[model samples]
Every structure is written in structure tokens, then in C-alpha cells.
Target: MKNNATLCFPAFLIGTLATLFGGEIVSAAIYSITNTTLTVRYDDATQTFSVTETATGQTFLIGGKLEGEAVKATVTGRTIIVTQADGSTASLELRENVPFVFVHKTLRNAGTTTTYIQRVVPLTFTLDLRQPAAEPRTMGTAGLTAPDRRPQHRPDHQQANQAVCSSAG
Candidate 1:
């Protein structure tokens, strides 16, 4: 019986080891976007975030205790709405794969009359996803090291200038 007990214990340990090492591991990549006006950091594992609106020097954080997680964001239709604890909200309009505008609207009341004011700020930046084994690169210089040799769409100079002038109005 003593010999049988020793053999059973060894067999049990071997089975445990096999179970522990028999599975595949999956990792999530970190995604980020940075420019002169804004910076965004997102962790794919936890769906957490840390973002900064550099133009207004305001930082909005979420999903971590040390970072204060005071803001909550939700996507609705083509917009991402970020609401803070203080009741202020910033709405970002999505275009294609990027955000095109940040809009903030406020309602004010004076002398029994209510007025609504809206502010719109345009954002122009490319979303950059980090590769699992790659090092971080500087903003606006990610693809500069090895430029794409493929021909890109180049509009006619006169037509482009006319379109720009027309849109300015």
C-alpha cells in the first residue's frame, strides 16, 4: 500500500504539469495616437485608456485607480461621447477610421431666456497601432524611415486650389 501511494502521488503531479503547459497564450497589442494637439493611449487587454487634449491642455483618464478614471466614454452611431464626473462632455465625430471634430455644447440661462452655445474644434491625426515586437516611434515620423514607393492620388493643382478656396467659405 505504501508503494502504491508513492506511485499515485507522482502520477498526479505529472498530470497537473501536463495540464498547465498544454495551452496556447494570446497577447493583445497596445494602440496609440499622438500629434501636436492630442495624445491617446489605449490598452487592448483591459479596454482602458489615458488621453490628453493638448490644445486645451486638458487630460481625460479612465479605467485605472491611480489615474482617477473620472471620465467615461461610449460610442453611439458615428460619434464617441466622453463624459466627465463634473457633467461636462466632449463629443467626437468619427470620419472613416479617425476622429474629425471635437464638439462641446453648453446651455446658459439669463433673464428667463435660455441660450445654447456650441464650440467645434477640428482634429487631424492618424491612428497608430503598435506591433507586438516593435519599438515606439516618434509622432508624424512612423513611416518616414521606409517610405511607401507606391503612387498616391495627386489631384490637379488648379482644381485642388479651387476646392480649397470654395471650402473656406
Candidate 2:
């Protein structure tokens, strides 16, 4: 529901990659969309993103590298459709009151001949755990020495698990 998110990083390395589509990579403008708990910013030129925790003002970036170019991005309702230069598409959907954003990506063959994609890394998170607000929390438990030490954002494990599982499906 918040709309004041900005794009600035203090702990990341930004680098550009050569174009993969055999055409000039256009530097598109940056844009953002928010869910209930996080604000996500995307650089269309690099096809990279940064996530900011809405409550804590903590920001995490795609560490040290960039991806392919995004030719277009369309925001429809709570979903963002991004079209890459290689004919692939990635859709980012944000649900109301949900902290997690679901991503669905489709890879396509841009060229006339058949090609193979060896590896695809959506993004790499470089977390700054040194910050006091970035300290990890052991949810649904009082002590860290518990038998099952699961790092969860929500206080209830059942709800957290359900939220993650359902959203991922």
C-alpha cells in the first residue's frame, strides 16, 4: 500500500553485460511495485531487482551482477509482466497482505534455430546481516537451542509454512 520506495543501494556492485539478443540493449527506466510487506524495484535495462522490507526499511539487492535486458514491463493489477529481449517472459505477482512475491518465468527460443539454456539464475541476494534490524529470528520458539530451528518471518510456523507453500504453488 506504500508508494514512497526509492532505488539506491549502499552494499551492492553494479555491472553491465553485453547484449545477448544481437541488438542494442536499451536502458529502460526503473520502476517498482509493492505488496503488503515488501517493495520491489526493477531495473529494466539490467533485468535485476531489489527488495525492500516495508516495515524495517531494509534493502537487499542482486549482488554484483546483471542479467539480460527487459524490453518491456507491463503492470496489470497486482501482477507485473516483464518481457526480455530473448523472447522469454517473467511475471511477478504480489498478493494483498502477502509478504512474498511469486515469480513465474517462461523461457523461449528467440532465434530461428534451436538453442539450449544451460543455467538461469533469477537473482542473487546479498544480505547485510550486520544491521541490527537484519538479525535473523527464530519463529514459534523462545530459545535458539530448540530442536527444530527454522528461520521464519512470521511468528507462527504453521501460518508461515502455509503461506510459503500456497504462494509457491
Candidate 3:
């Protein structure tokens, strides 16, 4: 019984350690661009990635097994590299506070040369957190409605007449 217990303890410890830190750590974020919402995820260990468009429900896999070939992903500091099975590669460098979309395309007439460009764009993000809801407020007593606050538009002739009158005065 003592020998069996000792054998099981090492296995249990190894299993526990693997469970604690074994696979790649994945981080994901949802970014909004114009009318599209994209969810992108990066695997820290493998450096492979995928992006899903929420509107179309389409997913694109990059340098992963899902591409029907084994690919290797590596990260050195802020730079990530993904080497495809065909010896092709893609890379991305992390930038501070800058939102960008990686556009990958094959160069026309370039014979298998592919290019990856980072296009910086504005993004909006929302976080889900528990917070106290605010009570709705009633309209103020100032009698200012939505239309009253809007700028009034004048005709071109009226503006011209006002300008002439002001200049004359």
C-alpha cells in the first residue's frame, strides 16, 4: 500500500502542475469598427490566433491546426510570429494604446508573396461589470425640449439680407 501511494503521489503532483500551467494562455477582446464587431484572440504560448466577425459569424484562423496543416507560433517580447506549414510566415508587433487590424493579402502577380499590414482604426469597447443602476430623471422645469435646443436654420436669402443689413449698419 505504501509503494502504491508513493507512485500515485508523483503522478498526481505532475497532473496538478500541468493543469495549473500547461496550455497556452489566451486573451480575447471585442472591437467595434463602424458597423462591424470583431472578436480577436491570441494564444500566448503558441502565438497562433483567430478572429471572428460577430455580424457575419465568420471565423478566420491563422497559423493554427485548423488550417489543415501544423503551424508554429512564437512570441519574442512584444513581437509575435506565426510560421505556416508551407514556410510562409506572418508577424505582428504590439503597440501601446493603439488599435489596429491586421490585413493579410496575397500580392497580385507577385507569385506567392503575401503581405500583412496593420491598419490602425478607431475602436469602441464595452465592459460587463456589476454596478448600481441610476434612476431615471424627470425633465427639468426650464421648459427646454429637444427641438428648442437645436440650431435653427435660416434660408440663404435671409442670411444674405442679414449680412447686408449688418454691414450697412
Candidate 4:
């Protein structure tokens, strides 16, 4: 039985999103991190998250919510970290200047004895792909631009990168 497990989303894709859509910052139970072309938000009360296109205000996630109840929420720079009652934590970080956000989740077993984690679902969200209008594109280091998904678009890859943690035997 492992004590900890970690899962992370692709940094490059979200980083690209941040670089393309830019905006200001706001505060409240629902926190927002905006890049040049997109906005990422986390609702502490509901333990939910969402990504929106700044131009059209169209959100990419529908009925999005984390799997657990959030006990605490912390913000540092452009990152938001939410801690759950089970000692698990989820972090969403938005890079500066660049366009994308980095999402990471850590599942922890706080009990003294070995606990078998049936499954730790970090988030549950239905992706809203109503107005898919983005094309696959890339940018150089010097400058960058997102796809022409004015009304909206979707990420090229459906899955995110996973980081496995060694068990404390």
C-alpha cells in the first residue's frame, strides 16, 4: 500500500494557453488565473475548477468539481493549492508571461496503518466542446500565439502526464 500518489497535467499545453490569452486577477471564494488567451479558475467552496477563453467567455469544462471536500485553499503567486480532509492536495499554477497553467495533485494516506486506496479521483469534469474551432499550431521561444479558436477550442491531447510516488514500505 502506497502512502502517496501524484498526478500532474501537461505544463506545455496550459503554458501555451496562458501566453495567448492575457487578463487581470480577481479574488474571492472562486479564484482566477488568466493568461493572454485563457482564464483558469478554482472554486474553493465547491472544490471545482474551470478554464475559459477570455475573448468569448466560453468555458471548456462543464460541471467540473474535485473529488473531495477542500479543507483549506492557499494562493502563492500565480498558483492555487487546495488541501483536502484526507491530507491530499491539488495545485494549479499559472506561469508568468507564458500562457498555460500547471495542474498537479497529490494523494496522501494520513493514517498510521497502511491504507489501501481504492482510487483517488482528483477531479471530475465534463469538457464542454460545443464550439470547437482551434487548429494545431506551435510557436518559437521568442514569440507565441494560440490557435484561432475564437468561439473556442480543445487541447490536442486528452490525457495528462502522471507522476508515480514510491510507497513507504
| Top of the candidates by lDDT | 4
Which ten-residue region of model 3 has the weakest summed lDDT? 6-15
Enumerate residue pairs that collide in model 3. Answer: none
lDDT values, one for every candidate: 0.33, 0.53, 0.31, 0.62
Error of 1 at 17 (Å): 33
lDDT of 3 at 48: 38
Decreasing lDDT order of the candidates:
4, 2, 1, 3
Q: Identify the superior model by TM-score, candidate 1 or candidate 2.
A: 2
In each prediction, how many residue pairs overlap at the backbone (N, C-alpha, C within less than 3 A)?
A: 0, 0, 0, 17
lDDT of 4: 0.62
Q: Give me the candidate number with maximum TM-score.
A: 4
lDDT of 3: 0.31
Ranking by TM-score: 4, 2, 3, 1
Score every model by TM-score.
Answer: 0.24, 0.52, 0.26, 0.59
Better of 2 and 3 by TM-score: 2
Summarize candidate 1's per-residue lDDT along 1-169 as a digit string, tens digits.
0110000000000000111234753323334444454545444344344555547745543331111122455445434444445344444332333322333322112223332223222222332233432443432324433234334544654344331101111
TM-score, candidate number 2: 0.52
Q: Per-residue alpha-carbon lDDT of model 2 for 46-75, expressed as tens digits?
A: 566666777887775444233445678767
Predicted candidate 3, C-alpha RMSD: 24.1
lDDT tens digits by residue: candidate 4, 34-147: 666677777655566787777798877655666677787776667778888878888877776665657788877665655545344666677666755463343544245444
Query: In model 3, how many backbone clashes occur?
Result: 0
